[model samples]
Target: MPVELDPVKSAQKRSDYNGIYRLEDLTRLSEAVLSDSGQVDVMLKCTYDEQKLPVMLINAVTDVDVTCERCGQPMPLHIELAATFTPKTMRLEEDLVPSNYAIVEVNDYGLVDLRALIEDELMLEIPLVPKHEVENCAIKEQDMVWGELDKAAYEKPSNPFDVLKSLKNPK
Candidate 1:
């Protein structure tokens, strides 16, 4: 289900939110071959820094179906990720922010979409390139070949500077 919260109020109270969102609900995510049964589980906590800047801590796991780059077969990937988000504020110096935390520019309405934030985080955690384990891949070594020169055929070409050397020597 979608979740929305007031950033200021939630942070002040240090609210704890735990819920599961349907994977189908995230439209902005890259398209993957989804398993019939998959879910996004999340635990979101809101707190304020010493300076009263709102911060969000997220813990989440999601299941997604992805094609194996090697075998071209669909496989399930369990993605686990954690993230920290602080609403950007004029009062908060960027240097004060921890390297691990990401800054978000909250909308003018001061409302945050909890589901969307977590969804975006999970998306980022997904691998840029997905591949099945070598042993698990259906493709065999014989099926694919990387260029390999026969030892006898391996011969080095003359150096590019050879022409200049010969020109100087005139031999």
Candidate 2:
């Protein structure tokens, strides 16, 4: 089942969850993806560290199709997220959290929604300018240039700066 557990309680109990979440369920992610027909494999574990601080470690993997910026064609993209987070509770100060673990806010019920977390991480993994490899892309670097340059521009022998030279040495 989709993970939605109280971080504080889960940490105390040392809970673990592994499952698949539908991409279509993630509204924001679905909108950005080319097709909302995929699943994210999620593995989550909640426990305390050496410092006895409640923390959760999560890993997720998924694939989506994104429009290539270069050719505007659909290209497959893989996403993976592996992160450790410390639950931020009223008693836990942000500064006290360990540097290695990111701080995650708890809901009103002190629960951590794994689906939302996966969605956020997956969104971040998407590239700002998606593109295929140079060899595989339909549009090439050479083809990116605009229409051919005017041959007359380069062939013209007369120098426009000659007028300046004449002004400097008015013979």
State each model's CA lDDT, in order.
0.77, 0.87
1-171 per-residue lDDT for model 1 (tens digits): 337767667888888888888766776654554553567888888898766668888899877888887788987788897888887766768997888889876667877777788778787787777888767778877776688777767777669998899899985
Model 2 per-residue lDDT tens digits across residues 119-170: 8988999999999998889898788767777788678599989999999998
**Segments in model 1 whose C-alpha atoms lie over 4 Å from true places:** 33-37, 50-52, 147-171
- Candidate 1: worst-modelled 10 consecutive residues by lDDT: 28-37
Residue pairs in steric clash, candidate 2? none
Clash count, one per candidate: 0, 0
Best by TM-score: 2
TM-score, candidate number 2? 0.81
